[model samples]
Every structure is written in C-alpha cells, then in structure tokens.
Target: MELYQLRTFVAVARAGHLTRAAEGLHVSQPAVSAHIKALEDELGVALFTRSARGMGLTPQGQALLARAQSVLEQAEELTRAARSLRQQLDGELKIALNTDAEFLRVRELLSVLRAEHPALGVHLPQNMSHFIAEEVRAGSLDGGFVYGEAPPQGLEAVPLCSFRLVVIGPLAWRERLAGATWADLAREPWVWYSDALPCHASVQRWIAPYECRLSKVAVTDYEGTIRALVQSGAGLGIMREDEGARCEGAGEAFVWRGDSLPMNAYFLYRRDRESDPAMRAVLAALRAVWGLEQPLASAHMRA
Candidate 1:
C-alpha cells in the first residue's frame, strides 16, 4: 500500500531473512515484519511463508515481485530525472573511513565534493571495516570505504586498490625479530587491533597456518593508536603498505617480511540506491579522484 512497505517487501524477498531486510533498510526486524503484514492485509494475500531456514515468498508473492520491482524502478527514475533537471544536491552522507584514509589520499575526493556540491553535508567517521560494512548495508551511512574482496549482501562494492599486510615492530626489535618465525612473533606481546576488524581476521588466518599461540597486550581499531604503540616498543602488529612508509624507511620500525597477507579495499554502497542523485554525485567524485577501473558487476566475497 505504501512505497516504504513495498521497498521492505522487496528487500525481504531478496535477503530471505527479516533481520537482513531490516538491516538493509536500517529498520528494526519487527518493523520489517509489520511492513509485510500490513501489505499482506491490505492486499488480502499472503506474501511470505516462514520456514526454518528463513522467510520465503509464497506463490502470490512471487507473482507480485516483478511488478513491485518495476514500480520501484519507475519511481526511482522519476526522482532521478527531476533531480537531473535541477542538479541541486542536498543531504547528509555519513561515510566510513578505514585505517589508511590518509594513505589512500581521500582529501582530493572530499575537496571535489565540497567544490561541486556546497549543500551536501559529508561526515567521515573512522571505524573497522566490518563495522563500516554493516552500517552501509543498514543505510545509517550513505556508503563507506571498506577493506575486503567484496561488500556484504544487498550492497555493491567497487574495488579501490590492492595492498599487502606486513608485520612491523619497533626498530629496537629488528635484531631480535630478524628471521623470526610466526611462532616467535606469537610469543611476544602484540599491539592488537579490534577483533572485529577485517584486517585482524585476515592476520589471524595468515598466522593460523603457522599454529602459533598469539597474545595481545593492547587492542585498538585506530591506526594512530597502533602506530604509537608499536613506535614506543609496545609490541609488533600488522600494517598495510603506506601505513608508515617513512617510519620503516628511517629504521624507526622493523618491517618483517616473513609473513604477509595480500588484501584489497573497496567502496561499498547499497545497490538499489545507486541512482540517487547524491549517491551518484559521491561516486563520481570518487571516480574522478581515484580513477579506478569501471565498476565491476560482481565483487569477490571475503570476510
């Protein structure tokens, strides 16, 4: 009956879970359920059937799905056409900044957006990749820079660049860490990152093959905190290329090459919202600055 309810129905059908649909819409699970229930009641038909695995569309629901999508697409096209006429961008976009925002040279993108869209309010918040991915999918934020092969389901991720994770420690440990095996590094106190971080997960997997018993002295998701800790001889940790190139080149920290993890970063945004004027503007700004390849239809999935 309502546009929001129709959108919720499509999201639920795509995700096959009430919780997942709620996340993509940035609403509570109960809210999603209510939307579906209201729609079904108004139309006098059952839309979805509950199962042990998840929600599934009934025969009538499947019959209605295509028409629903067409309606949504038509509405979106109307909005896009009208906005294209005025070209007045206005809205708040909250984006997630990963650990290496500086290294990624994101100032250029922000500068372009400021010069182009004076009415657009952009907020960049620092967070772990996993947390950022969830927020982007939940629509709390417009989009984000996330580290992983792909964005979460119901979102589209464009590959930004590739970087390798390398171990680094205080220069004082250079002599001690030379040729240090994974087992040796595991024994030492570590400047660990938030366990929820994608980098932390990757590092754990990379080291898992070594069968090392890892220990941590401090935990933080902020790169600055990790850098300071490692700089002050706290312990060793992983950093991507360009995390602290000057420090490593100056012998301030030991760059251990024994164990390394190859990784990629992506720009993640909700798929259905791509045609939004503000979102399109943001994507254009990123493309202008980063000059990445044409957006890929399928993103490789990774944690």
Candidate 2:
C-alpha cells in the first residue's frame, strides 16, 4: 500500500531473490519478506510463489507490476517537481563508476558539480559497466560511466572517450611472444575476464576470425586482478591501452603490438530523466570535464 512496500515488491520481482532484493533495497531479508506478506494480506492475493529456487511473480503479480512501477514513477516525478521549485539544487545523486576514479576524472567532475550546486551531494559506487547500465535504467542510480559499443535501451548516453584494448603478458613472455600472430597468441595460456564483462564479448568477437581456442588459466572480472595475474606470469590478459603501456613501461608486462580492440566509454542515464535539472547539471559537468561540445539531439547513439 505504501511506496516503500511497492518499491520492495518491484525490487524483489526484478531480482527474483529475497536476499538480493534486500541487498538492493539496503534492507534486511526479513523486512522484505514482511513487506511482501503485508502487501499480499492487504490485497487479499498472493503476489509471488515461493520455492527453493527463488520467488516467482504470480499471475496477478505480473499484471500489477506495471501499475506499481507507474505509481513509483509518478511519486518520483512529484518529488522532482517539488525539488525543482527550490532556489538551489539539493539532493544526493548516486553514480556508478566502472573503473578507477582517476581515469574517470571523478575528482574533477565532483569539484565542478560541487562548485555549481553546493547543496547537491554525489555518491560514487564502483561496479561493473553492465551492472551500472542496468541500475541506471532501473532508476537505482542517477547516472554512470559505461563502456560498450552502444548504451542499452531506455538509456541516453553521451560519448566521453574511447580506449583500445591490447593483449598483455608477463615480462618473461616477451621473448616467447616476439612477433606472435593471432594464432600464436591464442595458443598461449590466458587469464580471461568473466563472460559478463563487455570486454569479454569484444575479445570474443576480435578473436572469432582467428578460429582458435584459448587456454584459460584463470577467469576474473577485476582489471587489477588481471594485471596482477599477468604480472605474476599466470597468463596473458586483455587490458586497456594506457594501462598496458604503463605496465610495459614499468617492466611488469609485455604489450602485444597486434591489432587492438577499440571500445567507447559513455556517461549513461535514464532517457526519461534527461529533462530533470539535477541530471542536466551532472551532464553539463561531464561535458565540461570531457571537453565535449553541446550534445546533438541524437548524440546518445553514434552513427
């Protein structure tokens, strides 16, 4: 009946697990369960079917989910309208960062935002790029930096920059990998990224024409872990061009001179919130920091 209960219901429905929904809502599992139970009792119908696997929305729940979501959107719109009337922009904006703060220019971005809207607070949560996109689309995050060929549907993205991914190996492997071709590189032991990462797909596509299977020794999503493993001679890894150059310059890793995979980084937010003042403020700061011109009407996607 309350907005919190509806929010919990939507979160649980999307997550399909009590613990995950609780974590997303920043509440305890018991609290989430109680909210669902209370809502079901008040509505006189079962919202979800519980089992060992996870919660599944019942027929009625599925039908009402859209309505509940609409209600939440309306409530948020009302809040935004009220805040817009205030002389100063003041609220907490949660943004997700997919990489190190320095590379993202987060410090500079924050400084600009603070100077422009002193009352506005920002929260930077580090996460994977895809997860950041999902959270932004779901309205859990205000905006974030994501790396991909294009932003996901329902989101507007401003192109920030691009980086090429280069293959890197331990310093000891330099002699072994000297003048190595794609086929030769494929034969080497690899420290691969998780399939969930955007770079994983890029790597896969990049190597597809080579038609070779990699000997994966380890799999991880963290760039730091990949760098460390590669440095310790665990295997080869795909790293950003600048990072690979830094490691190579430090004599820690060897960067392959072969064709590199190119990727674009974007600042993404829910397309529906483009007109919101707070979102506009953040976007303006991002543009200034990235030295980008005024975004075109369709700049959200590259031609």
Candidate 3:
C-alpha cells in the first residue's frame, strides 16, 4: 500500500532473506517484517513463504515483483525530474572507494565537486572492488570505483583508465628472480591476495598456462599488507604497476621481469539512475578529475 512497504518487498524478494534485506534498507529486521506484514494484510495475500532456509516469494509475489519494481522506478524518475529543474544541485551521495584515495585522486574529485556543485555532499567509504559492485547494484551505494572487465548487469560504467599488476619480491630475492620462469617463481613463498579480490582472478589467469600452485605464506586483502610483507622478505607478492615501480625504485622491493596482468578501472552506478542530478554532478566531477571526455556513454557491456 505504501512506497516504503513496496521497497522492502522488492528488496526482500531480491535478497530472499530478512537480515540481508534489512541491512540493505538500513532498517531493523522487525521493521522490515512489519512492513511486509502490513503490505500483505492490505493486499489480502501472502507475499512470501517463511521457511528454515529463507524467505521465498509466493506465486502471487513473483507475479507482482516486476510491478513493484516499476513503481519504485517511476517514483525515482519523478524525483529526479524535480531535482533536474532546480538551479543548483543539492543532495548527499554515498560512494565507495575500492582502493587508496590518493591513487583514485579522490581529493581532486572532491575539490571539483565542491567548486562546481557546492550544495552537493559526498561520502566515500572504503570497500573492496567486488563488494563495491554488489553494493552499487543493491542501491545502498550511489556509485563507486571498481576494477573489472566491465560493469555488472543493471549498472553503467565509465572507463577511467587501464593499468597492470606486477609481481614483486624482497630486495634480497632480486638476483634469484632475475632470470626465473613462472615455475621457478612458484617455488618461492608468496604473499597472495585473497580470492575475494578481483586481482586474485588476474593472478590465477596469469599462472594458469604455467600450471603451478603458489605456496602462500600469507593471504590478505590489503595492498599495504602485501607491500609490507614483501618488504620484510616474507614472500613475493603482486601489486599495481605504479606501486611496484615505486618500491623497486626506492630499493624496498625487487620487481620481477615476467609478464604483468592487465586491469581496467571504472566508475559504476545503477543504469536507471543515470539522469539523477546528484549522480550527474558526481559523474561530471569524476570525468574532470580523470581527464575523461565529457558526456558519458551508455552502460558498458561485458565483452
């Protein structure tokens, strides 16, 4: 009957769990349950079947899911239209920062947004690349910087830049790795990234042809941890090209001459909210900071 109830319904249907839907909505579980109960009573039908596994959409709920989503989209479009007519942009955006702020030029982006759209506020929360994409798709985050081949479904991504991942080891191993092949390197202990990271896939692909398994001494999600471990002679690790160069130049780590993995960075947001004023302002500022040309294209598809 109410928009919030419909929103909760759609979120619950997508997540198929009360706790997750509540987290996505930023509300308590009880509140979410009450909303669903109220909606079901008003509609005179059960929307979901409660079971030990999780909430499952009933037959009627499955049929009405699309209509609920359409209603939400229409409401959002109306709000966006109203804001577009305003002389100045004014809203807060929750954006995810998947990597170091310095590397992403977040300060430069904030400066541009402050000057151009002073009324708009931005919040940047540090997150992992995979999690950022998921959060953006869930509508919990307005947008984020993600590293992947392309944006996931229902999202639009603007190509920021392309970079490579380089393998590095402690300075003590410089001579050892100088002429080492993939098999030789596999023998050495590695400070590897966890599988949850996108970089892990890159590393896996790079080593697939060689058919060797790395002996991981330490597995981490933080780039800083990997750098420190490699510097301490703990193990060889993979890092972004620029960071590896810096470490090698400073004599803190030795870069391996083997092939590097290619990666692309993108700024992603929900495709449906492309015309929102706050989203538009943020996108414009990001483009300026990254030196990308004006006028963002349609959602990037996976190739």
Off by over 4 Å in 1: 1-85, 295-303
RMSD vs true structure, all candidates: 21.0, 22.8, 22.3
The local distance difference test score of each candidate is 0.83, 0.89, 0.89
- Model 2 clashing-pair count: 0
lDDT (tens digit, per residue) of candidate 1 on 52-133 = 8999999999999999999999999999878865877887888888866666567888888888887788888888789888
Residue-level lDDT tens digits of model 3 in 1-303? 899999999999999999999999999999999999999999999999999999999999999999999999999998986785575877789999888898899999999988877888899998888899889988999999988755555678888888999999999999978999999999999998989887778779889999998899999988999999999999999988999999999999989998998888888888778879788888888878988776765466542
TM-score of each: 0.67, 0.69, 0.69
Q: Which scores better on lDDT, 1 or 2?
A: 2
Model 2 regions more than 4 Å off? 1-86, 295-303
Deviation of model 1 at 238, angstroms: 1.0
Going through the candidates in order, what is the number of backbone clashes in each? 0, 0, 0
Predicted structure 2: lDDT: 0.89
> Which is the winner by TM-score between candidate 1 and candidate 3?
3
